[model samples]
Target: MILCCGEALIDMIPAKTEDAGTGFVPHSGGSVFNTAIALGRLGTRAGMLTGLSRDLFGRQLDDALKASHVDTRTVVYSDRPATLAFVQLEAGHATYTFYDENSANRMLAPEDVGALPEDVLALYFGGISLCNPPAADTYLELAERHAGRCAIMLDPNIRPSFISDIPAYRARIARMLAVADIVKVSDEDLGWLYPGPEALMEKLAALLKAGPSVAIMTRGGSGATAYLRDGREISVAAEPAQVVDTVGAGDTFNAGVLAKASELGLLTPGGLAEAGEAEISDVLAFGAKVAAVTVSRAGANPPWREELAQERPPA
Candidate 1:
């Protein structure tokens, strides 16, 4: 099982009312939540680890997880209100305004977290959970605790606006990258982390030196590229799709990479370190295909395994 540790919240997306005026409608979403749901939909044994409120929105989040086949055993329930993100879309791209002060998911402390199950072979950490305090430190502690026992994949999903203290957040991210086995970053994220005249690949190399065995750089529309610590690199083109909204495109792409890697028995730290070029290329390609499906639709919805053709080799 791949355990996803982070915040789960509601996305208040704008919709046209009967009268034609725009009104917001709630949708179950969060970066980690979307990835967990995508993994479950792709038939991966996925579980969620985060603080959830007992409120209506929280219940909706829980139901959505189970409906997508994500295990909720590791969830921590509370009476606090759930976090919410008010979304604004333009030309199929999304921007969020968060309402998370004192919310259930943001109040998680290190003590609130528990031990991992023996079946969890990998742990994924990212989203706004890494951008806020208390919960940010909480998730990092959990990842650090289980770093070597299982594979650790991180996608900071960097949102500059969410970060209050740039230096402190950079330090935290540095520590996270040090312990992570695989790290994914977008071109914008890379630039933000290492701003200068250095090229994108050069910045990625600096990230590889931080400790992760593999670094994946995603280029919107242009596709993604993966780099190994030993200098091997693989790039894949983005799969064609009728773009609707890029809401959960990156999140679903992450699930696709992990799901395919796990399916190929390459989800372990050592396994990823020794993975071949063909295997890595296949993983990146699968991720692109999965993400293509997500961007071709509305919201953060990911495809079920049955929705795609059988492309994996026999186990």
Candidate 2:
């Protein structure tokens, strides 16, 4: 099973109400939540680990996870309110105003990261969960605990504005990178992490040296490239889709790659390190295809098994 760690919050997506005035509609979303849903829909054994509230919105979020077939066995419960993000869209791009202070997810601490079952072969980390407070430190501690021994995949979906202490965040991320087996980062994230005239390849190489066996970089619209620690690189073009919104594209892409890798039994420490170019190429292609289905629609809704049943590659 693939265990996804982080936030599970409501996204107040902008919508046109029947009254014609614009209003926000609540949708169960968060970077890590989206990936877990995508993974479950892709027919992977996925579960979520995060802090949830006993509030109505929290129940709603819980229902969404259960409906998605994402295991909630590892969830931590609280009486706190849920985190809410008010989203604004302009020319199909999205921006957010988060109401996360004192929220259930934000209140999570290091002690809340409970133990996992033996079936959970890999742990996936990312989202604002790694940027926000006590939760970020909690998740980092979890990553540090499992580091080189477990199959770990990280995507620090960078949100520079959300970080209050850049130095601490950077240092923490560098520490996590040291033991990650697979890392999925965007070109924009690379720029933010290591600013200046340094070429993209240089930054990626630095990440590889820190420890990941596979470094995957996604370039919006253009495509994504996978760099193996062994010096092999494979690039795949982004699948075409009528532009709707790009909210969950990257998260779903990570899920897609992981789904394919897990299917091939490559979501393990040794498998990732020993994977060949062909194996990595197939994973990237699957990710691009799955992400295409996500961006072709509205909100962070990912493809369901029935919707993309035929898209599944042979195991």
Q: Which candidate has the top score in TM-score?
A: 1
Cα error of candidate 2 at position 151, Å: 0.7
Residues 207-294, candidate 1, lDDT per residue (tens digit)?
9999899999998789988888888888999999999999999999999999999988999986777988888888999999999999
Off by over 4 Å in 1: 310-313
Clashes of each: 0, 0
lDDT of 2 at 289: 87
TM-score of each: 0.98, 0.96
Candidate 2: misplaced stretches above 4 Å?
A: 312-315
lDDT of 2 by residue, 118-185 (tens): 78889999878887678888988888888756799999988877777888889888877876898999
lDDT accuracy of residue 146 in candidate 2? 82
* Alpha-carbon lDDT, every model: 0.92, 0.88
Model 2: colliding residue pairs: none
RMSD (Cα, Å) for all candidates, in order, is 1.1, 1.4
